[model samples]
Target chain A: MERGTQPVIKARVHVGLKAGVLDPQGKAVEHSLHALGFAGVHGVRTAKSFDLVLDETDPGKARTTVEAMCQQLLANTVIETYRIDIEG
Target chain B: MERGTQPVIKARVHVGLKAGVLDPQGKAVEHSLHALGFAGVHGVRTAKSFDLVLDETDPGKARTTVEAMCQQLLANTVIETYRIDIEG
Candidate 1:
């Protein structure tokens, strides 16, 4: 399948803070959860997801493009890691 | 399995904007993609994920607990819906 004529591809990107990176937001949530009586829960990590739809049928190409997107803009690669899942 | 003695369960919560909700962030990302020559991409939506480790063994119980977490804190039910995946 060509680029424009390709099937619709969905890319789900999961961006998360790297281990040892300080996450104030996650810490705040953990505190709130504890206050709410969820003490048994710990190591709470907050992450973001991006759902992108592209007119591309090739999974490899889609992954490549979205991975670039993640590195360039979708995520801050300095202190974050991203996992991309592409499906048609 | 009992509450405190149960194995640790992982709950992945995906929170996404509800249909018909205005997504300015997604729009901004779409615009950026177009500027980057990804014109074939459209209908971008931004979302959040919460990875929680709970000291629970039963799948059903874990789901119930995480669903409550979503309703009470993790998600804004008015303009967002959350899906919880529990794993041991």
Candidate 2:
């Protein structure tokens, strides 16, 4: 909390299949929901999120680092999209 | 969309591991990030989300159904907590 000391920042990344992509897993879950008596449920899709702690002071820099991390490892941009949220 | 007909509702369920739960996978991710030179990253945690389309008109009813779905299928509540969001 002191000036010039590294600040801990929190961030969350959400990754989901891109629009127009086939989601067979989603379809299967929908069927299961219907069978379980959630009869009117449909159009099920899934996503994964990561919560991170960063030893950075600047929110901008933290977002930049996390964005790079997503690009390099977390997301498959070819068929998926991701959204990042930063919390101070 | 017609009166007396089922209305499609959008809902999202977010399931996350409870705090204090050991997250070895998160640790592994932190290590990987550090190895890749994001040295300041730590305390990484993960979660999953499901996007659902429900054929229910009432927002309250849709949320109730989604909550039940989370209990019955989407989440393992022993060590996890879930949040549900509905979009009209």
Best by lDDT: 2
State the lDDT of candidate 1 residue by residue for A1-88, as single tens digits.
Answer: 2345556888899999999998888889889988988877877888998888888878899899898888888999999999999875
Against the hidden reference, what TM-scores do the models get? Answer: 0.86, 0.91
> TM-score of B chain for each model?
0.87, 0.90
Best by TM-score: 2
TM match of model 2 to true structure:
0.91
Query: Which window of 10 residues has the lowest lDDT sum in candidate 1 chain A?
Result: A1-10
Give all candidates' CA lDDT scores: 0.86, 0.88
For all candidates, state DockQ relative to the true structure.
Answer: 0.75, 0.88
RMSD of each: 3.3, 2.7
Pairs in steric clash, model 2: none
Instruction: Summarize candidate 2's per-residue lDDT along B1-88 as a digit string, tens digits.
Output: 4324656888999999999988787888888888889988878998989998878789999899999999998998998999999997
Candidate 2, residue A76: lDDT: 89
Compared with the true structure, what per-residue lDDT tens digits does model 2 show for residues A1-88?
A: 3324666888999999999898888888888888899888777898899999888889999999999999988788999999999986
